[model samples]
Target chain A: MIVLVDYKAGNLTSVQLALAEVGHESVISSDPSVISAADRLVFPGVGAAGSAMEEVNRLGLAPVLKDFVATGKPFLGICVGCQIILDWSLEDGRTACLGLIPGGTEIFTPGPGSKVPHMGWNHVGFYRPHPLFEGIPDRSHFYYVHSYYPTPSDHADVLAESDYAGVRFAAILGRKNLAAVQFHVEKSGAHGLRLLKNFCAWDGGC
Target chain B: MLTKRVIVCLDVRNGKVTKGVKFAGNVDLGDPVEMGAQYYRDGVDELVFYDIMASAEKRPIDIAMVRAVARKVFIPFSVGGGIRNLEDMREVLLAGAEKVSVNSLAVQNPDIISQGARAFGKQCIVLGMDAKRSDAPGLPSGYEVYVQGGRKAMGIDAVDWARRAVSLGAGEICVNSIDADGTKSGYELKLTRLIADAVEVPVIASGGAGTPAHLVDVFREGRADAGLVASMVHYGTYSLPSIKSALATAGIPVRSVP
Candidate 1:
């Protein structure tokens, strides 16, 4: 069964329901054994990086997440859950993250006539071929609700890119057994559901 | 680039959608689940269900409807009305709604905004303000905040309240004009622009959405990030795709319909 890590972060329900829609039965858990034993891990989060990190550490699931990644298990993170895997985040005035990705996250300081939070649907341009994007079109629009985005040190880690306020950021990222998206795939429509189904069948070999 | 959002608002009273909403396949209408699924399939960026039931028993029925919609529809949708505190917000979100909007209760207790934002993150808290044109003393924008579903006017400046709500961590602001609600003549551009300019958060222009041209005006002139509609789509006056196509033709960036 797919194990969805529970760290008291939001969007767990939507993620679970989306998985169900894709014909997958997943269990939400913070238990170490359940998370580590599962074939795949779906880490979904919303809210500030500081508190989200605190919850991960509080539940003692941080180390478990690290070990799961190290084992080359299929894993995915969404939204802030995706951000927390980065080295650091500028949200809440700089919060330390899981450091799985070698870079940090920065808040969007858009030019004039740009709204912060970077909320709404925007196009995602694929940079590299991956199974996660099996049938999805290039530059397809997905729902986004975030003020900060990850700045991966290695450009090769970037799977897809999206522009906001003239600044193009990494909308989808992948490294070995892990894939994470800055957009809320659960909230996104058909394309999102397709992406989730692809991930469900992913074997951690990008 | 964040394209402008076209949202369909549904008013649910006692498990029944109170407005005109036709299902494409079925002849019968007013089913919230069918209408919501139809709108989502028609390319609406988002959906909002406002709980207007006054009875306690009907509240659970609304929650059930939210669950049903979440099961079939795969887009983001928000729930509002009768949400008094964080628990209520949690109930709606847990029931599968993405955001919980607070209007009259927010005006009564301002802390709920900050509290909800703190608990569920700012993205989940939406400030729904019903504003009316006012030239009363001390009213700067000539728009006063209205509460109790537009029955009572609080002398509070509309723009100021929006700013405060954002500062208190409101992720989005929905400015509904009491005067233009059902008139469909046009949106209250003045009020929409005032609040849209005041807050950095995304602002939705609601109340009067007569034609696709009105949405174009709000997106360009009013600077609204999103436009909310009910009567036009509900009454079958405009299909969701046609409205989006109109916005795109007018040179305004909008999500392409499916």
Candidate 2:
């Protein structure tokens, strides 16, 4: 069963229903044991970086998540979940992150006439081939609502990219057994469901 | 690049959508959840549900309804009306709302905007202003702010209040023109431009939208970030695909429905 990590953040029902739409039955739990034993793990969040990390640590699921990644298990993070996996974030101020990936997050300071919270559907450009994105067309649009994005030290981790306010930040990332997308795949309509299906069938070694 | 958004607003009362003209005469629409899901399927960029009866009942937000709609719709959903404190905001967000819009409660307690932003990031808070043109002079167009579904006027300058709300940590603002609502003439362009220029955040122009060209004018002439419509969409006067195509043809950067 797919395990959805709930940290008292934003909506999880949509994620649950989206999975169900794809004929997948997942359980929402913050329990480390269930997450560790699941076939795949999904971390979905929509909020600040500091508060989300605090909840992860409070539930003592941080170490469990690290072990899950170390085990080469399939894992995915969405929006704020993707940001928390970075080394740190500079939102309200500088704050530490999950350290799963080597990099830090920065707020998207758009140029003149560009909106801050890049909230809308934008096209995603594939950078490298990955099984998680199988059958998903290049330049396919996905729903996004965020002010901050991650900047990894290694360019090899990027799986896809999207442009907003003249800045092209990383939209999807994957290295070994772990993978995550900055956009809300659950909210991206049919293409989103196809992406989820691809992830569920992916072998972690890729 | 920022794309122009087309939104559908639902006046949800007791879990059912009730449509009216100038917020006076009421007519029952269909179920809120079913209508919300229909809009989502039709490729609406976002959905906003305003709880018009929460304050009259003196209860918290209708979280169950919010959850019901959120569970079915994949796009972003925002809930407004009767949100007074952080607890109320938390309940709505937990119930699947991406953002919480404050109307009457926000006017009564402006500090609640800051408090809500501090507790649950700024992007989750939207300040909704109901505006109407006044006959009095000394004010440009005599813009007066209204609250409680535009039934009462607050006598406050709409421009000044919009500036204050942005300063108090409102991430976005929705200017709903009560005079032009249900008229379908077009958006109050002058008022829309005034507020859009007054604040730094994205401003949504609500009310008086009949045709897709009107939406194009609001985005170009009024310089609004988004446009909100109700009757025209509900009554089947326009389809989402055709409207988006018209906006794209007009050189407005709008996401086409796939």
Candidate 3:
């Protein structure tokens, strides 16, 4: 069973509903054992990083998630879930993160005619062939609604990039067993569902 | 590149899809969930469901209805109407809506905007404004904010309201023209442009979309980031694909339907 980590950040229902659409059975759990034992873990959150991390530590999920990531199982992080996996976030006054991936999240600066939060459907360009994007076309539109984007300490870990207002940032990051997206795959329509399906079938080998 | 969003608005009342002219002359369209699913399949970028009677009736939004629609729509969908506080916003977001839009309640309590944004991310909070044409000297843009389904005017400038809403952490703004609603003449381009230019957040233009040209005009002239439609899509006048195709031809960036 796929375990959906729920620390009560936000929008866990949408992710659960999206998984159901792909015919996957996911258990939303805060239990460490359930999460660590699951074949795959999907950490999805929406909200401030500081509070999300607080909940993670309060529930002792930070260690649980770290242990799960070390198991070499298929894992996915989305939005704030994706950001919290990084080293730190500039949101909520520079909160420290899980450090699962070598990266830091920074807020998007408003450029000429470019809105903050970058809320809209933007194209995702693939950097390397990965199973998570097996069917999703390069430059396919995905819904994004976050001001912060993760910048990997090592550029090679970047799996995909999206350009908004001439600022190109990491949209998808994958390293071995861990995969994370800065956008909401649950709300990205067909392409997102297809990506979720691919993740369901991913063996965490590549 | 980010594509311009085309949203399908379903003005639902008592759990049924309803449409009215300028917020009156009510008519039931069909099942909201089924219609939303069909629109999702037709390649609409987003969906908005506003509970028409929630605010006026002093009732909270219908969670079951929002759940029903969110179940079928895989794309992003927003729920509006009667969201008075962060708890109400939480209920709707937990019901599976990607965003919560505040209209009359937002005007009554602007703090809900910042609270909702802080509780949930700014992206999850949407500011929904209803505006009517006005020529007051204080309102140079000639628009005033309306509330309670356009039955009451708040005497606030539409442009100023939008800017303040964004400052309060609203990620996007949906502006509906009270005078242009249901007329199908076209969107209030002047008013929409004024509000769009006033805020950096993405602005969605609502009301008065008779044909594809209206959408083209809104995006090209009004500079709206998105367009919201009800009658055209509700009555099967134009499918989402047809409108998107027209937009693509008009040089507006839109997602290609498979």
Q: Order the candidates by lDDT, highest first — what do you get? A: 3, 1, 2
Give lDDT tens digits, candidate 2, residues A1-206: 89999998646877887888788989999988999999899999887888998899999988999999999889999989889898898865888888899998878775556777887778889998888878878888888888998898899988899988778999998889889889888888778888888888877877
For residue A104, model 3's alpha carbon misses the true position, in angstroms, by 0.9
Q: Which portions of model 2 show Cα errors greater than 4 Å? A: B135-142
Interface RMSD of 2: 1.9
Q: Cα lDDT for residue B248, model 1?
A: 84
After superposition, which runs of candidate 3 have C-alpha atoms over 4 Å from their true positions?
none
Candidate 1 on B1-258: residue-level lDDT in tens? 689999999887656677522211112238889999999999999999887654233243367778889998888999888886688888888888889998988998999999999999999999999898987988899999988767788999999999999999999999999888877888999899988888899999998898999999999889899999988988899999999888888888877765
Writing each residue's lDDT as its tens digit, candidate 1 over A1-206 gives 89989998867888899899999999999999999999999999898989999999998888899999999989999999889999999988788899888898988885557888898999899999999999998888899999999899999899999999778999988999999999999989999999999999999997
Q: What is residue A190's positional error in candidate 2, in angstroms? A: 2.7
Model 3, B1-258: lDDT tens per residue?
888889999988887899999889999988889989999999999999988888888899988988888888988999998787888888898899989999888899899999988888788888999999887777767899988889898889898899999999888999999999999999999988888878888899999998989999998889899999989988889999999999999999897764
Q: Is candidate 2 or candidate 3 better by TM-score?
A: 3
Question: Per-residue lDDT for B129 in model 2?
Answer: 94
| TM-score of chain A, every prediction, order shown | 0.98, 0.97, 0.98
